[model samples]
Target: MHDSSVFLIEFGAIILGLGLLGRLAGRLRFSPIPLYLLAGLAFGEGGLYPLGTSEEFVAIGAEIGVVLLLLMLGLEYTASDLVSNLKTQYPAGLVDAALNALPGAAMALLLGWGPVAAVVLAGVTWISSSGVIAKVLGDLGRLGNRETPVILSILVLEDLSMAVYLPIITALLAGVGLAAGSLTLAVALGVAGLVLLIAVRYGRHISRFVSSDDSEKLLLVVLGLTLLVAGIAQKLQVSAAVGAFLVGIALSGEVAEGAHHLLAPLRDLFAAVFFVFFGLHTDPSSIPPVLLPALALAFVTTLTKIATGYWAAKRAGISARGRWRAGGTLVARGEFSIVIAGLAVTAGIEPSLGPLATAYVLILVILGPLTARYTEPLARRLTRRPRPEQPLAPPAQATPVDDQDTVGRT
Candidate 1:
């Protein structure tokens, strides 16, 4: 076969394999993320077939995928929702983050990694896979339930916290000499926040321009804006994902229904490319010999997230069942974890550490969806009573119409 044909065949195989695995995962009551990783491994250097792309391309694709993911998240939430859910969600988010970070850092130390490496590793474990959790809930037709909304709200809160934490952690890893850069990052974030406020303030007016009768033109404009903001954020040395997210949040309140319709296809297409690209970069051979330590790190981090999230949910007046569900739902990690881990690697943390981090992420990606699938059942069993339904009132009846007729006749 010609080289071009080989490339096409490999690409097609990947897509088909991922789709098949995803469907099969549903049937088997597991999340497809692990299968995607397995597919990557199978096609990777260690496996039978290899698509020998440079690391740069894969990294670029992964970065774009994560930015788009964050943008979608931002598009789904509003400031009002944040405010309303903050009381319960924020505490839960904080607890989960703290639990994941502290124990994870300790585990990293136990593995004989440096403090900076440990801190970054801990941060990776701190975040939950919000996308996976949301997808699972929606698939199960539980998205409309009260608990589903609460879990989603908490996930959003967690994302917001991560948005702040990532930069700080990045700065720390950049070393003491880069304190000025950290300060600059702080200012840039503040400016981004201001820009978001302005966008929200004028979103109604902006929507008029983008929500024309011309669907094609409107979509083009929205896409253009998304890319433009993403670029500007990148130029500012702030996270492009943050800019994309802010844009989404700005437009979320006014243009949600229309925006969803317009962006759905584009989002899915870009997102699939992103995940595929994410998988394409994995060289299984690079995974460090410290597999035992990596596993230990992943286990501790997962447990911490579960315990702290559950405690916070309970304190927030969630039922015992809801608490259990929240805990399990929040334990899965994803793209952001990988992003932070990658940043650490780029910052010269250590060579072996990056692969270790990747392995941990791979594990969570597998476990997150599976745990989420069964969270509801576990919650029900733990909290056992069916919640009472609201009672209906009896129908009102008229006294005999004949009596009224007789009185009128008299």
Candidate 2:
């Protein structure tokens, strides 16, 4: 009875603190991710005053947080969309991996962390933060810009790649041999292919099966299904995140929309907890030792991400300004990077990895928004390029992109 009371008091205070921090971040027009990590650090193992009872609950919440994060991300597109993006935008995806992932792999090897840790860190650096980028696009009104589709295509490809990448990492971290790891990869690929096939052919039927007019029933059913699949996936040695993502892809139309609308708040709450939970396990003192390495990584990857965006946009024939925007937009790394590092940390792969990832993400997540807003303008200033001049009289307005049929075409 005493323990229960303490748990309630500690957790209640945590939620309240997160709320206040989130509010502060909103006022500053910044993501609250860094602040949440800081909160966790202050209250975690080596920090000010760690809580005893709530750590277990926070751990569970964090896992759910990761599952929900991937699930909702899947809901944003159809299986067909993933296929199409892969077909059309794979060049960008390959370039993205080569440019962004290699640096991380190099860093890990340079630190003598071995091949497995290298692969893990490669993922940590390769993927951009979809959540942060989506928000920046909305806030900046770039949704209709010429390069927006290019940016989105790159993001979609990244999401698709994770379906395969997560399983390989999971197997590697488990210390499975080559034969067993190959089997795991084959299984993951087969499952992904099967799910995509089902989604492409019978998605509507699946949606109908899950659909409910009552919001309460709908919410429970969808959430229950996601968790169930996630658990089974974990049991099968596939990543639970991949399973949740597949479930999301399997639902479409009204069902997907309703599920997304219903699940977003829950996702946000759990996702915040997940980040804090990661911090809870990391010692604050470990971070300073890794701070310089994290900074170097963050700097190098920022440029590489920009280069990737620029190259991708150029391939799609975007203008100089739009290209810069696309590159700048991909600079921030967030949830996915941590998700990768979290797997490694949980596997006890390297003592320094968790601290390094924590510091690295904190730096980039904060810088992501600033880069998104400024990189293009900064490029212009550096080049001393004058803005295209308008005629004295209001020139004939160009036809809308749809009518003109080109500028923003993907």
Name the best candidate (by lDDT): 2
**Per-model TM values vs. the true structure:** 0.80, 0.94
CA RMSD (A), model 2: 3.4
Residue 51, model 2, lDDT? 72
**In model 2, where do residues sit more than 4 Å from their true spots?**
385-410
Query: Tens digits of per-residue lDDT for model 2 on 251-271?
Result: 999999999999999999999
lDDT string for model 1 (300-379, tens) is 77677667656766675666666666667776777667667767766767766666766887787777765666765766
Which residue window of length 10 is worst by lDDT in model 2?
400-409
Candidate 1 segments exceeding 4 Å error: 1-13, 45-47, 53-59, 172-178, 345-348, 373-410
